[model samples]
Target: MEYVKGKPYFCYCDGKIKQYRYLDKDIKCEILIIGGGIDGAIANYYLSKDFNVVLVDKGRLGMSCTACATALLEYQLDDFAEDLLKHMTEGEIVLAYKMGIDAKGKINNFIKTQGNYCNFALRPTFLYTNSFFSIKSIKKEYEFRIKNGFNCKIFDSNNSPFTFPLKCGIYAENGGGEFNPYLFTKQMIENSKNQNSIFENTNIVQLIKNDHGYIAVANFGEKIYCEKVIIATGFNWEVLGIDDLCERFITYSIVTSPLKDFTWFNKALIHDVESPYHYLRTLPDGRIIYGGEDTIFKEKPINENVSNKKYDKLEKDLFRLFPEIEGETKIEYKFCGCFGSTPNNLGLIGESKIDDDILLFISCGANGIINAMAGVDVIKDILLRKNNPLIPLFSP
Candidate 1:
């Protein structure tokens, strides 16, 4: 898939930091990771700690979907827990929610270990509903989360954030945060450099399964022999014939110039109950990044006119939510990227049904960063030949 168009702010901020040499020789390792995005980096970080690992990407690392990501590290799934209960048993739903929540903590801990280099900041999240009819459902969701001992509080319109038309809102404490995804991916790769080999501009053209393991042939005919192979290519997993696992869509986002007066409520990560909900966050430098005008994926190149219309909608919505910064804000960046959506809003992680020696760690959904963090532990346990309890929860 054509992952992104327009300048992704994070990429621009980081500039061209470093470059890796392309692969020119065949290599052998205990584990081979294809794709140098966030998932691949996380996998490399854990697997390299104890085994020989090789990570390769067709292009620059973290320049694809990872760079374009909004990077909201929240445990709140796109599908609420109360709604999931309609399809799954209470125990199943609770476990899934707990896993998501635990993923947030894991992410925090991992960031801490890395010296919090990714602009990691713990913040509150507000899931609100503007419609009166939606209030009851939102209240039910709030009650369900609270009943499960989650940190949540319900607020009526009278006490909700100013400028937000809220009938009710769920203020979740210690469940969400934001980070610089591009930096996180790069740091992970750098941290693993000692124990792992990274090959850039090397495409794995074919995979051959042998009796003992798998052989991945690169574009230049350089083969990688490994006991296990992992695919973390995001929406482009069609190269591995697993694109059908999740539906793809396009989402737009805009980053504004530093505002003179930031009037947003506590600068908390804010989202709504509406479909294609608008999400907004404030950077430390006083800039606001807002995203969420999503549509079904189309195979055409990014059209400037279409992108402008989407940006207009996003800008208009931003003004409606926070009219205080109307004239003061100027959009500095606008971009659109393909986002993979799963049925249950949880990431897909496990061994491939068709290929036994191959593992899949596709983080599909809004909680992708957190899911990827969770997946690191799961994949590590699998490599160690230990049973991961999350296998059944996030199974492919």
Candidate 2:
């Protein structure tokens, strides 16, 4: 399935990662990770530290859905805390937020230790709404955060820091991050311990269970005999042959040509509270990535005609937020890709329902990269036969 379409800005960036060869023979290991996107790279990077691990992908790593990710690593869910109460406890919601903050810290530490080659930066997050109806909800969410001891401030039209109109908004001083997703994926995979065990263009076609474990057969008839499997193929689940994992959607994004001396309030990661809402962030080069306007996925490749319309809408919306840029800059890139979402706004990152030995690393929702950063520990705990409190929230 074609999960991404158009010229993704990340893939076209200057930094090119090292390539890996396809599997030519059978192999054996304690754990085999299928799908070499950012999620897989994260899992392999941490898991390989203790296990005999091998990571493989059907195609090149971080060039599919990962290529198009806006990568707003925020410590907030797509839904508000009150709405998530229907599917999760208040404690779980708080825990998820804490996990997101922790994950952001981990990413910072990794960059500090490994060198900052991914253009990563810590940024505040601003979630706002101009609608009167959304004001109450935004206030409630802010109250929840303050009650939980989160450091943030509430804004209204009287005290709004942004030029755009705002009825109400929540600002977290240390709530989010932004980065070059493809480069971050490259850094993780390259720094992983099992470099010799990583392969690209190596499709795993079947998994045959045996008394000891299972044998994963490749498209070219090669095999991977392993004790466990981790599927991190983003929204492409052809290998699992199952469709009920989560609700899938195609999200559209557009990037603008750099504007001279233009910047938002603190360059904070921004999200609006509209249905199928929009998000925006600033790149190091002054270009803005604006995205959203999602549609349900129906097991079809992205339609160019529909994508064109979506791009047009996104461009207009971008102007709506920042009218000064409408005549100054034009869109330089347009792209869309599939993403999954669960009711709880968490990911399927634990043992699969089909088989206990087969684990899943499908990081879903808007903060997927953040979820994956924290979720690796859940997978690690499961492999170590330890109890993880977050397991139930992300159980597959």
Candidate 3:
């Protein structure tokens, strides 16, 4: 069992979660899933192969925060040394890094087999820090990345293009990619349905540990029994009435033109070397979208005036590169969500203390697409009662 956030358990849905109309019936399966976001959907996809699976969500599959923005799928470690030093030892960082890389490979393989049209293309991801202090750490992480069998390079304006006033960056190749989040999530939904594994627009109201195993009751008083429950509810975990997750970190993001013809560079993904680091990549249609810069808190500031204001500033920043886009470019979408970050910026995985039969899987500081496969590995270890790469590190 793990320590849970000492706060009331409840999920608060934005307009998205509310729009879903779920079935009012009782269901039973070997694994009962809560939340239909990417993490939950993918978890169901893998777990259902051998187990009778049932998934419930407050909204449509992948329609929530998962489909709201462009997914920058990459395994590039952002501020790896700093993050590693704070939450884990160097050895642990190395292990986690390997796991991320392996997870990324697994996702790519799955996409290929499914013939998904999400534009899951591989490219290099670069991380830079405007601060001089990052130089040393960047060097350390770069070495660590390469030593662990990754294709990586270290950049200081002097070696590469000083095209800008950037200080230092670590560029890792073939470890990252970009995709159309909505389409990708949609494909997974189809796959799950074909397998007879997905329950769409189903709002799970409660979970109780019964002697048979676990019972999942939906909004219409419908109930289902299963051996275990997996919760990947994203920002709404607390909303599930789970007491262990109370400290939430909120973030905002927007999408723009894909990085197709970069009058800027040949690469599709890049980021500025600064705190609140910004990661940008091009979509299939050549639209480049950037995200990062989060302010931690209890609730989101959802107002057109406030959102547009931040968007305005971000637009101005983009103009500095393609001055022509000042008023030429228009926003295609806007999104905001809370991430459940652990003290170490790592995700919390494995069995939950609240119920021995429940497994709590969370995605916070890191990118989900790349981490999903690693998550599958954890779930497998839990089910098989065997040792997995991610179990020891993530188990509560």
Candidate with maximal TM-score: 2
TM-scores of all predicted structures: 0.95, 0.99, 0.87
Q: Ranking by lDDT, best first?
A: 2, 1, 3
- Which ranges of candidate 3 are over 4 A from the true structure? 1-21, 147-149, 161-163, 193-197, 238-240, 243-247, 257-260, 300-305
Taking every candidate in turn, the Cα RMSD to the unseen true structure, in Å, is: 1.7, 0.8, 5.7
Candidate 2 segments whose C-alpha is farther than 4 A from its true place? none
Predicted structure 3: clash tally: 19
Worst 10 residues of 3 by lDDT: 1-10
Candidate 3 lDDT tens digits, 1-396: 011111100111121222334655665688877878778877877777777887777666665566544466666544465566786777777777777777767768879899856667777777776678778877877777777667787778788653545678877766577666656655565566324546666667777778988777776777787888888876675435754473664345656633434444445477765666666665555555655665555443444354456566666666665665555556665555555556555566788877768887776554655566577778778888987767766765
TM-score of 1: 0.95
Query: What is candidate 2's local distance difference test score?
Result: 0.93
Error of 3 at 184 (Å): 1.9
Please give the lDDT score at residue 165 for candidate 1: 73
In terms of lDDT, which candidate is stronger, 1 or 2?
2
The C-alpha local distance difference test score for the whole of candidate 1 amounts to 0.81
The residue-by-residue lDDT of candidate 1 on 61-173, one tens digit each, is 99888988888888778877777766566677777677777877877787778787778788888888888878888878888888888888887867876576788888887
What value does the lDDT take at residue 34 in candidate 2?
95
**Candidate 1: where is the Cα deviation over 4 Å?**
15-17, 193-196, 300-304
Q: lDDT of each structure?
A: 0.81, 0.93, 0.64
